[model samples]
Each structure stands twice: as structure tokens, then as C-alpha cells.
Target: SSLIGYGRGDVRNTVGNIPMEWYQDYPHIGYDLDGKKIFKPIRNKDELDEFLDKMENPDYWRTVHDKTTASDIRLSDEQVDLVHRLQKGQFGDASFNEYEIHSCSSGPIVEKKKILIPFSVSKMVHAIKMGWIKPRKPKETTPQYYDLWAKEDPNAILGRHKMHVPAPKMRLPGHEESYNPPPEYLLTEEERLAWEQQDPEDRKLPFLPQKHSCLRAVPAFSRFIHERFERCLDLYLCPRQRKMRVNVNPEDLIPKLPKPKDLQPFPTTMSLVYRGHTSLVRSISASPTGQWLVSGSDDCTVRFWEVNTGRCLKTLEVGGAVKGVAWNPNPAVCLVAVCFESTVLLLNPALGDRLVVGATDQLITSYEPPEEDKEQAVTWALSEGPEHDKGHRLTLTHPKGVKQVVWHGKGDYLSSVMPDNTSNLQVLIHQVSKRRTQNPFRKNKGLVQCVSFHPLRPYFFVATQRCVRVYNLIKQELTKKLTANCKWISSMAIHPGGDNLICGSYDCRLAWFDLDLSTKPYKMLRHHKKALRGVAYHKHYPLFASGADDGSVIVCHGMVYNDLLQNPLIVPVKVLRGHQITHDLGVLDVTFHPTQPWVFSSGADATIRLFT
Candidate 1:
């Protein structure tokens, strides 16, 4: 191993640049050139020997420890001289000179020659390469090209607008900006201090008013350069646009609509009022022939009324508050379904035709189930003795309260909604002829608000809190889900055409959905001030009505066109107000007459009103 010094090969340690303390306890400090351990030098100097060596040795001052070899290295004369030169801030190599002159004339030089070509020759070569100078026409037809350089009228171009607007002129200098001004326009000492403290943009005047002896005596404007810079910034940063003003008649903006007077056959005024119930009337229904109307009330009574006159034909005490009442839509049958608590009473009503009433009673009691069939969702029992005397032929007992009952178009089948959350028993379809019940849904989506049967198809609609589901009874599968986009749906009604439907919500919104268009609501109408309790569509007229808690019924003409491309036109025609708000409740249910353009509404005022 050799020492690392100036002008000496540094090939001592074979272990690379590592700390010497790692080998303190080992016998060998490092490896040598042949990969063999270099043993540490033996000194074994005592304190007296070290003192004697320091006193006698003349080169002790230049001695340094070499940890790699565990020995002491002495500086040579040449190394000492180099160290002295480095300490004096001079170059270590004595032969090297820092400042030296260089000359380019001593090397051989070559000159470059410039060559130029004619511009026409290069252009001809480029044209030949691009085939612009063809010898003959090609066999294939060439693409058509537009002659951009052809002469044409500049005004005939499409993008060239004829209108040209000039920049707005700056405002003239006000009296306050004059070098000399009236005394009233001058600022007080307090006002001057306030102006200086305020923001530049907030100041009322851009310049301070002053009085000068004469025009010649006025000093040069002090803020001329700053004002010019601000003006330049406004021009560059702020965008200015000039819009054309259009003159249009205000009346032309309104849509042209037929006058209400022209839409005559619709109900315009109250024609009758049947008062019999002592409590709030919850539901109302008109018979198929529009001759009789039945209503159910919270007073535990159901009243049958004559549509032509304001007379309560009969009132039967059911022992429980009635929740819903629906008349058979088929003119061939004379029956009414009244739901109260957990029981639904199929009453003949016995008001229309005698033969029809008798046939309805017999039709309801003709069903007899087999002895082995014991899994019905509802228990069917005959209404005997006193109940039969009151026209109640059959009674349907369910496990939960039946909120509503809707009959099929054929009048042989009916469905009920119980809204029971404990079990998946919210909806049940009943076939009166067979006296059998079927629970269509095994798992309820949410609280079932209402249920309805399609007017023409074998479909059922069940409305939950936020959406409405359409089920095809024939297929026994969900056909489509209509997004009502409401907080809480209260009721639903299908149009006679069966292509559209409307849902009323407790959030005072009415959403219309087109089955063939989209599942999402086609239009959302908010014309009621309070929650909507009931909504009904006319059987033959292009009209629909809504009863709200605000004690008002709004009738709108909803004309549905046969063309698929045209949207339905909705127009509010009348607002019938007669039922008074009682205990935060108003009109509870509404139904349209089957044959006439009239409507019947049962309200919390314990009365039924007919508008004709």
C-alpha cells in the first residue's frame, strides 16, 4: 500500500472509500494490491518514549497519522513545497501559467464560396414534381375545386354582416372638472380629506375643482399621464358590445288560446249539494250512467245521492270511518265498493235499475271456493240478515286497513291497497266470480299510496311515495316504472286513452307522464297552494280536475292529440271554490261524471258538491 500524496499513485486501499474506524479492533487495517490483509504497524510506545521521540525527532512537525495502515506518514520535500504554494493561494503546479496569448494566424485557413440559382428554375422543378405541369389529361375525372380568386361581389358573402357600429364617445368635461368653477361646486377642507381617503373609483369626481386667476395662469394638469394610463387600461381590458334593439308588441308574445266561454259544455257553476254526513267526507264516486253518486265519510256512514237533485237517497252506518268508495265503471253492472278499516263491503246500492242491482248481488255471491283452497289473501264472507237488508251483499276482510279499492273495466275484478308495512301485503287483486285473492308483490317497494287499473289494457299501476310502477297483469311482470319526482304521491288517474297518466302529490305538485314517451314526468304543474288530496280525469271530455287542501278545485282542459309528434295542451279553465277548510282539511276526493262535463267533490265540510 502507498500513501495518497501529490504526484503519487493513490492505489493503497482495496476496500474503496470507507471509514477507518470500522477496522479498529481487527489485526489488519485494510487489504493490499494482492487481496491479502496488510497488518497494522507495531509501535508500542510508552509515555516516556513518546516524550523522548517528540524532543529528539526533527521531522515530527510534518508527521501525520495514516488510519488505513495504522501508521504515521512523513511529508517529502516536494509535497511540502506544494502545500506551501497552496497555502499562499498560488497554483500547485509551478510550471503552469494562467494568462497565455493565443493567435489564429498560425493555423491554415480556407475560404467559402457563395453559389446562387435562378428563382424561375427552382419554381419549374417544384411544379414538375407536384404534377402541376401535366403533359396530358388523366383517364380518371379530377375533383371539383372552387375558384377562390374569381371576381365576385363582396356583399354577396354569407358571413359579411352589413351593420357597423362605432365606439361610444367620451363624456364632456363637467363644471367640476373646470380650472375655474362656482363657489358652491368647491369642496370644503373636511370634504377634501374624505375624498383623499376614499377609493379612486368611489370618488364622485375624478378631479378636484379649483379657482385660478386666468387661463394662462393655470398650472399643467398634474394627473395627465396617470389619467391617460387608466383610460388605456379601460380600452384594453374592458369588453364593449353593441346589441340591436328589437321592437315587438307585448300582446304578440302571449299564446293564442280559445276563450273559456267558447269551451262551453264544461261545468261552470255549482248545481247541487248533498249534505248528510256529520264528519269529513273522505271519498266520492259517480255511477256509470251519471244518475247516482255515492260518498263515504269519516262519520262511519255512506250516503247515496241523486245526481240530478241535492237529495241524500240513503245513508248506511258501517260502524267504521270509510276510507274509499268506487262505483263499477261498467254500465251493465250496478255496484259500489266501500272500504272501511280492514273490511271492504261490496254493496249493490239498489238505486239504479232493479234488474241490474239484483244481478250484481247474485254475481257477487255466486263464488264458492273448494275445500282445499285455504291460502286466500283475504277472507270472503256473506253479509247476511241486517247487512243484506242494507244492500251489502258480501264483505271482504283483510289483515290491514284497506285505503282504496279500484275495479277493472270488466267489473268482475277489483284491487285494493292496504299500505301495511309489517308484511309484503300492500296490494291484492280480487276476482269476485271465483272469490279468490292474489298478492301480486312479494316485497313492497315502499309505502303504497294508491292503486289503479288501466282503462283499456290488462295493467295495474301502483304508486309509492316517490315513483309509480306499472305492472302487466297478463304477463305478471313489471312493465315500466314512472318517475313521479314528487315527495309524497297522494293519488293517480289514467286517461281514457290509456297512453298518459297523472299523479298528484302532497307537495302540491301534479306530474303528467306519457307512457309511450318517457318514464320521467313529461310536465310538472304546480297550480295548487296546498297539498293535493285527489285528482280525476273526465271520461269523455278533454279535461281533468284537482282537489286541494286549499278548498278549491282547479279544472284544466288537457287536450291530447292523436299525433305522436304533438304534445298535449294544458289550459286552466275554471277554479271552483265552495268547500270550506275544516281542521286543516279541504276537499278530500273528486270524481267526474261518466256522461256529462260535470264533477263531484267530497270535502271536509261534511258535504258533497257538484259543479255543472
Candidate 2:
């Protein structure tokens, strides 16, 4: 074997076996009497004797350490010593002085020195001297556990000091508790009475965790918990609320609209009840002359009645329920166009104006017109609707059912919507004289809510769920895509000036969009209590109205000035509430009178109201 472990077998690690005198005489990488390091070996007995002579004078010193032997601050030796002594100091009274931990909270609960830094004076002094922070004054000490434990001696070897701590907690008495203590010992008068009022059956066992009300909400615990824990949680996260602002004053670009206070209040009266339909009325229209009011119902009939009287005038059995009705504005010939199923019937109500068509059952059974007039009478119908109606009838095809219908300014063009299915067509426009139909959509978007044609220009608007698209009719290209930033478009009313449009949404928002003021709605009204069903802009007045399913109507003045720089006026005029809700349904439609401030509203309650 090599001499590395010759006959030793790990016993070489024993240090006690060596002579202490020889260990002392060795100069093994240590300092001399003058505090100078010496690492050289002793080669002879004389050198060993020299080392032993040096060792006779013991030398003790601490190492001057550095983080990396590089000083950015270039601290002096005295400063380094001061830092070291400051670290070792407990109370900033003396360097390297010992301090026994004392806690006023629970009679010196912690005997460890480092755990008492919160109550130390040196920590605050070091923060003031080195960190440039103002030292916090030490508070007078009060021992919380002095009553439970024996009084502590302030002059003892272990240092004593005060500490901030909560009041002593309530605990179950020791094993010596032989009887139930009075309520006064544990609870206040109010708590004692509340505890006494508790039913014996609902009382829980003692000593186990008890269910209590919220800490801050419970008045009994207000002394201990002054604020709710939610305040602290709110500091970390915010809460949600309505972001809309009401009663905001308009800018100087516009002024408030003035109205007469003595005029007939809205919801004038139930002057007449036009009720002849067996089912719900889906569409209602007043003639351009305001002489006759026409209505379509689910009972498969289109009825015309005198607007002044409740008497029914004419009822045409188109063999299906009526969905839409509109009167051509040409006074030379009053054309009553009706949409039943997918077909539009153009009936000349002028000749048969005297007697109601369905006044007697025989009128409906024998109301066949002459064969020569059938071609012009049944003007236009979708190829999909009423396939059994035999005759050479003028017809136009549509992709879906027509929900709403509107006439152009000259009564030459027509626009209608089909909200159900937009597979091939969303809006259809038909030219009566040319007998040609044009569909304005190329792709199926969301549920098409409504469509309106420009009064004079060659453009039309189609409103989908959240967006409204404007397209030029002649060029067959989109011109503008207006975003309402609302949920589910419900209705739209375009201004006669052709520069602004107002939209109502199911989110209870009334948004006004300006073509010149940007595609986004410039102003929004979000005060409706429920989903808005219909909206209308008066033809001659500056008034605009929005109706909701909550049976309330809000009228706002939305007249934008002629000047480009002036802001639009949008002051809420009034909230007319007189319609009665029926079977969870309210106002279904609202329309403004073309010539007057009067507005007509239809509700699910089977009543039509004329509000002037």
C-alpha cells in the first residue's frame, strides 16, 4: 500500500492524538504577534523554535471583509468598523453589547434577539444615520399579558421594552372552570341579551368555531373591526357599474329646444278603438291624407277603417295573414299595397270605398273582381308566397318573408326587410313601373333588423345586429358602414335632410349617427328601462321618439343645426307613459305623423293610440 493510508484506516482524522504543545508551536497559515499573516513552513528545529517563540505572544484580530474586495463608496477603515459595530449594537447605546429579547405583548414571548428588531432602537437609528430617514419615536411600553403572567422586572439582565399588539383574545377557561360563568364576564349587555334570546335548540356547543355574521357588517363587532375587509380588497381590484352619464349639458354649438307647455299632453285619449282583427295586429299604417287607417293582422286579412270613426271600411281576404301594408302617396289613385305571405297585393280601394269588404260573409265569398282588372289588381308578389293564387299576376320573388315595407319619395320604388333568414337576400328593392327586383346584399350577415331608402338620393340603408350599411343603389356598392356600439339593432329612423340617422337597440340605447360627423354614433341615450322596440323621427318637427317594451316612450329633440360646426341638439323632451302592457308585451310599433306633431303608437294590448 502507499504511505497515504499506511496502517491508519481513517484514524488519521483524530486531532486529540496530537500533542497540544506541538499544535501551538506550528505556524500553519496564521497571524503573528504583530497581527501580520505568516504561511511559510519551518524547515529546522531552529525555525520551529522561532515559530514557538512567535506563538508565545498570542494575537487576536477580526477580518476586514468586503462584498467583492471592491469598494464603490471607498469607505474608510473607521467607517467600516463603525458599520460592523452598528450591526452588532442592539440599542445604539454601545458597540457589541448583548441584549436579551423582551416583548410587552405576552411577557417576553420570544427569547431570540433577532425576532425583536421591530422593538429595537438601533434599527431606527441605522435607518436615520445611513438611510437618511427620520427615526420614529419609541412608544411607551405596556405589557398586555401582565395580568395573565407575573409582572416582569425591568432591571433584569434581559432587556425590556414595549410592543404594539392587539387586545388579549377571549379563550375558554382552564380545567378549573366548574360552573357556567355569568354573561357579564364574557359579553357586553347587548351581546348578553342577544345570547339569551337565542333559542336553545339552535345554540351550538361551546369551544368550537362558531358561525358569525360578516365581521364588519355585524354591529356587535364594530369595536374590533372598524372597516370591512372589502375595502382592502377594493384596493387591489375595481367594481363594475353603469358607465353612462345623464343630464350632461350640451356644448355651445347647440342650445336647448323650447316647446309649448299648454299643448295637449301626450297620450291624448282612447278616442277610438280599431279592433276587428281576430289575432294580434302586426302592421298599421295611416294614409298620406290621414283619412283612412289600414292594419294587417295574423287573421289573414287586410282591413281599412275610417281614421275619424271606429267603423271598419274594407277587409280583403288575401288567403293568408297580412305582414305589411303601405299606401302609395299619389293622390290621383289611392293604391293600397298589402304583403300577405310573400306576395304584395295592389288593390284600388277607391271604387270599393263605401262599404267594408268583410262587413258581410257574402262580400268575402263573392268579392271576385272582373277578370280584366285581376292583372293590375294583384300587382306584385314574391314567387315563394301564395303559390296557389291562380292568374297571370304581376309578381317579384324574395328570398324570405317581408317584415317591413317603405315607399320612395315618388312612389316609384319600394324597400322591405326580411329579418328571419338572410341566406340569399337581406333587403329587397322593387321598381313598380319596370317590374324588376334588386337585392342589395351579397353575403348573409346577422339578423337584418330593418331597411330604409334615401328620400331623394340613390342610396339605401340596411341595419344588421350591431352595424348599419349604406349602399348606393345605382353603383351597387357599399358607401358607409355605421356602427351603433349597441346590442342588437331594433329600429332605425333616417332624417329627411339625408345627413343624420337615429337607431334604437335592444340594449335600451338610443343612438344618433351623423354621416358628416363620423360613422360612429356621436351621442347616446341609455336610460330606457327595457329593450327598445321602435323609433321614429318626425318629418317636419325637430322631435324624435323611442319606445321600449316597458310601455314607455321617450321623446328627445334631435335637430342638428344647418351649420357644420354646431353640435346636434339632443335634449330629452318628455317620457310619455300611458300604454298598458299585455301578457309581457308592450308597445310594438311607433310612427310619427308625416304632417303634424302627432304620433301614432301600436301596442300588444290590441289598441292603437294617437298621441298629439
Strongest candidate by TM-score: 1
Q: In terms of TM-score, how similar is model 2 to the real structure?
A: 0.51
Per-model C-alpha lDDT, please? 0.87, 0.64
Global local distance difference test of model 2: 0.64
Off by over 4 Å in 2: 1-271, 351-399, 420-422
Residue-by-residue lDDT tens digits, candidate 2, 473-499: 789888999999998998888888889
Instruction: Judge candidate 1 against the unseen true structure and give its global Cα lDDT, from 0 to 1.
Output: 0.87
Candidate 2: residue 528 Cα off by (Å): 2.6
True-vs-predicted CA distance for residue 146, candidate 2, Å: 57
Residue-by-residue lDDT tens digits, candidate 1, 492-556: 99999999999999999999999999999998989999999999999899999999999999998
Top-lDDT structure, candidate number: 1
